[model samples]
Target: MPAPSFMGIYPADSVQEVHSSLPLDPLGPGAADLLAGDVEFRLHYLLQEAKKFMVHGKRTTLMPEDIEHAMEALNIEPVIVPPRPLPQAPFLAVPVPSGTSGAQQQLYTVVDDEIDFATYLKEPLPPALANSAGVKWKAHWLAVEGVQPAIPENPAPSSRAGPSRLPAPTTGAASLRPSAKQHLTTELQLYFSRLTAALIPTLAQLPNLPGNSTPSAPQYSFPDAERHRLAALASVRSDAAVAGILAYLVRWVAESINKTLMGATGTIGCLVDVVEAILDNDVLFVEPYLHQFLGPLLSILLTVPLGPHPPPSGMTPTTIELRTRAADVLAKLVTLYANGYPGLVPRLLSTFKKALTSSPFPSPLGSDYPPAGRYEGAVLGIGACGAHAVREAIWGTNGDGLRSINDLIGLLYPGEGRRNKAPLVRATMRALQQLTTPKPEGATVPPPDSAEVAEVFGPHFVRAFEKRPWQAQELMRLRKGSNGDAAAVQADAAGEEDEEMEEVQA
Candidate 1:
């Protein structure tokens, strides 16, 4: 069937336009037999056309006779037009069987109702994406060069023969050639590092760009680095190469989280997709390499939900597995520290305590640490993940993780580290605060504002915080007749003693 050109026509006016725009042979070949002259046939055609008008371009209002005659002319013996084009029919997208391969491979299928923009960005990285680095980078370069400020070459000299009066070649093509050729390899390395640093954090956040909320690929106007990366990604034959790229991407996501860079949050979804793709494709999941990616992945998974947005949509079985695997890895990491990585638990908790209590700093001003703009979500995510690990270590399987959590909280929040400029610290502390607040007997104290982080740790967080030293300090401060009472008494006595001594000296 011919694809309909009905889009862009509004329902209110399309009916009128449909009548005027009817095909030349509305009654088709059959109209010629019924009409005596061309004039009669044309009138009949117009009349038939008027009868076969559309509402909203999708729903046809053809009478029974019009349909019968039209079908006969077209040699469609049995015309089967539905009463209405039921919206539920999945015509726009076709699902591919799991075993499909080669050029027939389908990239994705949205089995659910509507795919959200963030979810599109978050969907499993296609196996095809595993090695598209070169293409991505080249496309980026092409787009950049397309917009490259056209260097006005010295208008082909006024006099061709004599020594040209052109100005000395200071820059542009003339000056760029030697360094360009020589630094080709080195420049790429440096550029990739810089690009990764600047771009990866923002990649996660880029999907959420305001106003342009629609989801589509060719994510942005392609850049040189993107084109190059994509092309490189496509060139690799072995799954190892793909895994390596994904592993690096995971590292980038983790580092971006650590550095508290902008857009780091969006990267979590992207990394999730990549990991999902690896699993879906049955590509060798390199344990050690993926291990590095796990921390950031878990951090992001734990963090982004604390923000206003929900996690990306379209949870594939592969994605669920990846997330489950990440959780498992996190449990193991915590266990490793619980068992022997002696200082890990304390360090993790220390980081969380510091992030929670620290004063808020805007992203740009705090760019050296994790910035607020992009890094906030990822930082929160990481902090939340770390908090979960701390809680799990302390309370889950054994009681050993408690002291470590206490030491971490004490050290990080200790006189001043708590006030560090990291946003993640602040966000996590916010989580910890909610976790520690007392419930009214049966009333739930309510989960922290950062719900995703809370979810990662479950109910154990409140239980664990109840025993921490910070809780004791806060309780003591709040208690009417605790040590706080003794401190007040001591101050009053000291003040009286000083006053009496001063009067005696006088």
Candidate 2:
């Protein structure tokens, strides 16, 4: 029977031809259509089964083995077909060219010969080649006498031929070296003694002498011995005795603060130098003694009248300068140890508030209290803490911080026509500027925007400045200008200032 045709897929003539080849009975009417559909369905089923086998072997393309495996899995017996011999074609021969060399002819003949893998495997391996000459090795002195030969083993001639003249000490010698503790202690004591003597004003000099009779106050000097001591201390790498030495130094400074304030500018400067030297020493970490050192350092920074009070002014220029120095030191300490001492920023903010908020004590003469150096120090200290610390400390969870900032801002104008507060006002303004300005380098987070500042202090900012007309100018100055305008203005002002100075000189 003949099979029906699928549209373009299977032709009716081909199916009829195939059916006629098979030795079967005559076809029924619908037999061809049923047979064609059944053959198509069976082919699709076989292909799907073969694909499963292909995937199981982790292959993309289908192989003959996959079809065989699919037939086995589906319980379908594969049809076995006898292999047929391939037909062979007669070889055609060509005559060699008359100009060809014998060597080239031999190469062509070798290529035409049939290769037998079994015969080649049966052949014995070839013998090794004989050595052409006897082996020899010779040695020679790399260095002749004192001068070394310019060989690969030796360094370049420009480099040192031997070890340096002053060779580093060996472990044995280093172990025998004497401890520097005792020497450092002696030097520190001597330096502090000299510093104290120079800083403390004598009773004879205490009473202001008429005219120039009162000789110039003694200047604080760093002697060679003191410098050597500081160098030794800085060189000491061991942290073992550092705590004790730091404590002793802190004690000396604390004791001298009172006497030094009696016109001991030189002593204060010397003390500041010592503190800076200690801070600069990488080997000595003062984290452990931070609390102990903070008290004395803050005393220097926030002391009311740094110099003698009986003088014309409560705070002299030297005293103000010392206060500024102390403030700088305090700021450095806070920056380095703030994380270790979590409460440090809060404590500093508190001290700043107290300095600005406390009413001035009545003087002996009943005159209005003069502005103290402590106010300046407090303002500088707050400014040095950086913007983030300033913001967090002043506007943290507690509302008191913002209140303090407001009080400080209020003190900028202090009513009743008193203008002696210019220094305090300037310091406060600087601190405020520091708080608002974004750090140009090494800042991890962007500074707070004007909106954030307004959100924090907006409610009280206007009210705080409303009563004080003088503060309006300061408030206006504190407001940040647009980036482009500020930059242009700064450049123009600098150029104009330079030109004016040059014209005046001419």
Candidate 3:
């Protein structure tokens, strides 16, 4: 649908008349209409902005000063008319000397009012006002930009005791003596250097080892790195005034994920660990960086193989666990921040859903739709979003060519990374298990019959959870899904009168 037309108060004839009064001559037929529309838009914007000033000032009606303020804001020079203005001067129409022999066009000018300068000067001298205080100057620090001087210009000790104060570098940091990056304090530069050195130890920082071919991969076991790494992670978990470093750290996370994801498992794990550490820090406010964090988290969780090439024999559980860790961070961000940031959950759901449904990579083992790791990560990410998301995406009625997870998991044909695929299956089961409605503290959740478990979660889920009967029974419990499916399943389970308690109790 087209946008509705906003009828403007400006008219074409008035614009044409104003144009005709100028030396530029009358505007063409169509030009005046266009100019009128433009004028209306500009006038509307100015007045609308002017209304803000009125509202801010807590006034009932807009004042003339507001319009002037709006003009200043828009960088337009305003016509400053005095409050007690003279009456509109009569227009003096003079015939313009157009070279053509046709009719001479008229140019209009405002008749200027005469003033008595001698009388105004005589009137101002009537009373002599007391001389205003002569200008004098004094200065104290309002806010210092960089390293403060040792002089008295600095605020005193009691004044410097506020929470905004930056911490001084330790003796170790003083020896390193790293210079501050633009606008960053010496303290933060030292902290970031130590932290990166500990957590993401690049090969260049170490001595050139004789046998290593992979030069750039991060060595997590670098000399003295682990001790410093633990200290760095602990510091991040409790550091104050780190908000200034947040943007740089987010950029670092993104860049490191892109560079290290295909090369080394340890490096990627370190990145996720740092993310979790930052999230764990109650001192640093992360709300501003939530959106930025999503890109790196999604990259970690959804990117397949997690290496340049597939592992020769079996997928490393360590590499796969990185996605799990990333999912945990993803969940922490969504579960905690979703309420404050509207659309965050839906956007996350859309991303995971897209990845979950994408076409499979052709593998020798068998194409199990999308890559197994990505599928598992997507499931975990959605599950992290809480019950509503898990309920809809996994168990809700199919739409947009969607199928339930019960149906989807069954389609996981014998594929590459099949060993690691067990985790994928387990991830699915874990997500569904989280949806069980809470029972009273003393009460127990009634388990559906084993025969009904196959009916509710499909044959594949029963097989997946067959050995662990309680898990399948957990899925069979009343789900927190919004639709009637969960209730229907609950009712069907409730109606089974013939089952022995001993049969399902096992």
Between candidates 1 and 3, name the one with more favorable lDDT: 3
Across 1-506, the per-residue lDDT of candidate 2 in tens digits comes to 55344553444556567889989887777566556654676677788979987998999999877776666544455445212332344454544544646432221222255779899869753321112123334575668998888876668777766533322112111211132233245654444444434332343432331221324634454444444444544433233444434544444455545446544454455556556656766767565456655676677767765554455533233565676677677778877888875557877778876765576544444445544566667766677676665544443333245455555544544564435545555554455554343434653432334444445444334433343323333333343333356688899999999999999999
Q: Which pairs clash in model 2?
A: 4-32
Report, for all candidates in order, the number of backbone clashes. 50, 1, 1
- Could you say which candidate leads in lDDT? 3
Better model by TM-score, 1 or 2?
2
| TM-scores, one per candidate | 0.24, 0.39, 0.53
**CA error at residue 1 for candidate 2, angstroms:** 96
Q: Write the per-residue lDDT of candidate 1 for residues 463-488, one digit (tens) a residue.
A: 34343446433422333344466788
Q: Rank the candidates by lDDT, best first.
A: 3, 2, 1
Q: Give the TM-score of candidate 2.
A: 0.39
